[model samples]
Target: MSRPILFFVIFITLLSCDKKENSVTDVQVLFEKVDSIQINYLGSPTVHDLDPLSQRVVFMEHSLSDSGHEIFIADFDGNILSSFIKDGDTRDTYGHIMAPLAIDGENSFMAYSFNGFIHYDFDGNLISRVKIVDFFNPGGRILGMGYGMEKWEGKYFYVNRGSKNADYGDKDFFDEYHTMYLLDPSTGIRESIIPFPENSLFMKGNFFFSRAWEPVFHISESKLYIVFGLEPVIYIYENQAPFNLISSIPIELPDYHYFKGSEKYNNEDVRFFGHRVTSGKISNIKYVDNYFVLSYFPGFDAADTEMSISTNTGPDFWNAMRKKYTTRIAILDSQGKVLNDFVPEGLSETSMKVKNGELWMMGKPNGEVELDYFQLFKVGLTTKGP
Candidate 1:
């Protein structure tokens, strides 16, 4: 498989597990009295990203029709405001936007998926598109090959895997100039590169070698915060070039099995991130309600799950692993201290976002309403992330 496809496969495949049937399965009763607004999804919707911009915004593939996947904007009362992009036969149809990077206010947002930094308004109007250069080579010659990006102020932070998945065995591919780039959107030039740490975060596989799977970060005010996909620590920086490491707060995961199983599997010479991040498979983190709330998997035990992607398929111990680990949320204080960790009922596989003291989760509503795919539950947060 190609690199980006493999990245999504690892995320949607390996991490997804069969959920448990709960006694209080009703999403409404589990949280607040507010009724949920259900939005119909097209096709087998891939809820790529979500951001609360006045109304909740979603990027998903909801129908099997020629319309492909679309960007849906909805109000808090579940009213579907509009769907962006025209219908297309294939997913790669140009006008369509897929994954989202950052949402600037309710109108403009930035994303880097199809090898460019694209900006779009909520109405799907094209704002700006900058062709990203290949940072792996000197003088930045190539056109394609860019990963995730987040914009703080006018500078956009661009990151790459530094090495290609297909170039695994090539010695020359390891000599990457940089993995992280500080890009000036106006000039279309890389201002500088944030150097990698001397140590590695790799466990036992090559999966974590790419920036594609590293800590997903957010730019809050003047501070840029980072949370690793497999690590428990939250790193803070002074949102600028040469990102100065301010603090690293360790999230206290409750489950013992969840914590132990998240560490390095063995003494093999792993890559970079394997050694850096230990468990809790952090999926999403948002600054809401003056609190930095994060959602993460409790993580499957390495010994029992045999998590090496090269060796174990995701479904092999899917049930057992999912049963063993609990999907939980860690809420951080304004000063970034661990507030509390609990599993919010009915929070499904889709992305989670908090806005105006309300927590929104996306997923299909059980078995009956499968066609109405893009499901969402808005629960009033007894807390915030701002």
Candidate 2:
């Protein structure tokens, strides 16, 4: 395994289960900015997860001169408690830290890179490492690369897009392309579960859409919550061996538009299609406590995207889109019913995590402010009485 491959797989996955609330309560959701924290780092880091044990933020700062990737643990008051860099050339650094996993137990959290899973303490010391190949049966070969490793309720689940049963251009390609597996690290036993919904847009040979968008999912409370990009629907599943579908909730999004892929596009055309495309799509699906937070682009005009590319102003187009389109978040109850959906003010759509039962979001960047510190703010969600 290499760094980019692991990163892409991790990206695809960073890209949920909790309890039973069968009834949808009729209430309005409101977001209020509460407290804020700042970290004096300027590498455009991404917040991976909040460590429950230490209550510190686990984030990554990349492009650090020559160190490859660095993970940092910091307090809410902008204090960097500890940080470590994992270089592929280093002997025991797990061949470069690819992605950080949820905090494990009280002493440490887990991360995966090109080598395998690496355990590190709060002080950024390597506790142990397990190779990726060890997760399979001895002498048993896997046809495709195993990527997107997520830990849920003591077991590890990985998504493998390769299959011996189908090829890329086959009619059943998409079905085989999205196979997820459940693995027990203790026994090295793996079970295949969860495939792309048969009725998904990509299953009908819409490869362009798949190329342009990646699926976002979360497993919570022994259940799987996923929103395929370009599809404004949440698919809930029982996160067991068979991964049975529980419910499919269609989200009512305002100002949402999507591009339908044309079969005539080739590989090069797909790249161009993604660049000139303007569509409203779900960017992330996160499960927080009892509710789910969904981030989405509220649609952009194709003419505007085309003008930016044609006028040599492409560099400014993306930031303009972020300011104009503005990411909208939808709050759904445990049962996948929409409680409320609105654009949160002064919050960036980068990463949102729940801390102490409140949602924390990255502060949206204003052009006027120098990018010297990373700021996070707590957004309190309240329900209005029916």
Candidate 3:
């Protein structure tokens, strides 16, 4: 084949998986529940960050205070080491929204917020805080919820919201919106690199629905992996400067179903609620070891009472709707082939992380369990003949 033709063939393979056969026969995934750690805490807590070197995990609980958050540090044994509510000076308290925590290094972690990075030790002591604007100005539009950020190859990488004047009606809007950026705090230089994929479903037609989801992504070694909530595609990019797209992996999840929203209703309109609630979304993504770990909510399909939008609009509407969908975890290889996909009992969709080369997930609370206690476990993957 000519060089141009070979390049075109490879590009086509990256774009879609319709021509490929099922890869499950070649790879089998077996998960072994290693051990469970029961943590004792007051309110409901979600895993914010895990530090294997320090043997500590950070949990965030909703606070009634003006700052709206509290932090707890617990060891691998589930013993609460320290807990604190934001207080003292402006440097100590974060913004109203709770920023996701990233493990900085040994015995310390950092929170990336709209203002900048706040450093804290595992003992609940504040180290220092740096505002990005003071060092690197990200135009006038950097004050938004950052999805996730990490220091890779001496550069800070994070995803920020796109333009405020985004024209949703335009078919090309999603492709042009830059959502990822690289910042060198030391050099005071920043560059917006990745945008939504040009071949994304949102870029396909008049799909004007913007779920306002913060894209979940991770940088592992020399590669970057990103997966949007509204789509099932995992995009791979080079982890260096310019960050060009390497390939696109479209996943065909089992039992996944969705309903595309109508363009007439804006993102916030009530009329779009049915489509938004019924749609299947990629809830979480993480790259661990050589595999990609993903948790997703397979869209609910059931009786009228379960799916009805009108009857479900009570105070507990959101909670009730959540019970209808089952959350499943899938282990995918570096090539985006599903090795194993199954729903594990007693695991929360929001609290899974890679710890010491294994997947650790926080336990989902059953109504019978005491609210103060949290469960943690290590998932071991074994390969067998399909």
Candidate 4:
């Protein structure tokens, strides 16, 4: 064959091979069974916070039968450690706890928009209360909700505050914004590490935002990683403008309809669905070694009375209408190159944590949501050889 024809044939062969590799659809669960536990609260557990250092988990319990909210603590194995009510019996009316119980070993911190921030010791003793001011100016335009707490070096602790304009829907209201702050755990003094910007479009929505909601952290002692949507951007300084763009990874999905089956109405006769597609609403992102994992939940449409009602329609109709998409975990390199893709079975509430030489995740088994239980699994990654 001529040189030009030989080159063309080789190019076609390589393209064919790439298509074949991408078309394969064998999904496998990577995590091995370690242990499982069930969390029981006095009422419905709305939000939970985990302290891996102390192996402690704290959650908020609100009684649907009554109008009260209580904070409870437990070990990782679900053993009840402590429980207390912050607001006596005044009824939190908010219906749910907005913040997680921030725990640092024996010390715990809880923040409520209406009640401000409260601190507690490991034994669930009230230590101090800091009334967060300055942000929420006159007319209460700023609402500071505690998102995540991290212990930096020495007594300098960091509390991430997400702010939203109080009057969100009105024409006179401005768009919501988010900012992070560094605080002295002992003196209760906080300095604005990152100031709140007006009309910041990082991440703002009812379901999820690419830049906002996701936790930004210092991946190493020096390097910080901030995940904005599918892209993970890094910054050298804690308070640096024009963040150095690190890497952007593209999230690959099988089909658009994979997330459309979960549409339904809730008990309140309110249609709860995503106006946009689920693939667009990226839920969680975590950094593991050199790779990053992104997880998303399908969006639902408006809810009607018959949203949860099931019919005896054949298995095919049920399968077509009630189908659920497998949670996708895309492994990417530091330069944002997709390394591999895998789908784990029985994965619910999928969140990532790094420990030892493996990637740890907490999720429930398939079809176990009806039972109100969840499980944790560990997956060993083979980085040396393919």
How close is each model in CA RMSD to the real structure?
10.3, 9.8, 10.1, 12.2
How does model 2 score by TM-score? Answer: 0.75
Better of 1 and 2 by TM-score: 2
Model 4 TM-score? 0.59
Estimated TM-score per prediction? Answer: 0.61, 0.75, 0.77, 0.59
Task: Point to the candidate with the largest TM-score.
Answer: 3
For residues 1-386, write the lDDT of model 4, one tens digit per residue: 00122211101111123542464233321334343345554334543455545666666655544534666777767677787666554432222233444555545655533444556665657666654455342221211112344445533334344334343323322133333455554544555544222212332222222122333443344444544332233322332333333433344432322222122322232222222223333444456655555554432323311333335435674355334443455445555444544454444434554433335455544442454534344444444222
Candidate 1 lDDT over residue span 290-373, tens digit each: 677776766545664335333454565556555666566555666655555555545563256444445656543455644644
Over 1-386, each residue of candidate 2 has an lDDT whose tens digit, in order, gives 01122211101100011111212245755566656777888766767666434667777765546647677888766788888776657666766443345466566777654566667788878788766653422211211011134577677665443333323344555666555556554443556666778776666675453333345667666778777667778888898767888888777655566665555445455334654356677877777757777888766666764564464656577777666766667777766666766666567764665444556677777767778887777666666756
Give the clashing residue pairs of candidate 4, or none.
Answer: 106-122, 210-229, 265-303, 271-302, 271-303, 273-300, 273-301, 346-366
Error of 2 at 162 (Å): 6.9
Estimate candidate 3's alpha-carbon lDDT, on a 0 to 1 scale.
Answer: 0.63
Task: Give residue 98's error in model 2 in angstroms.
Answer: 3.8
List lDDT for all candidates, in order: 0.49, 0.61, 0.63, 0.41
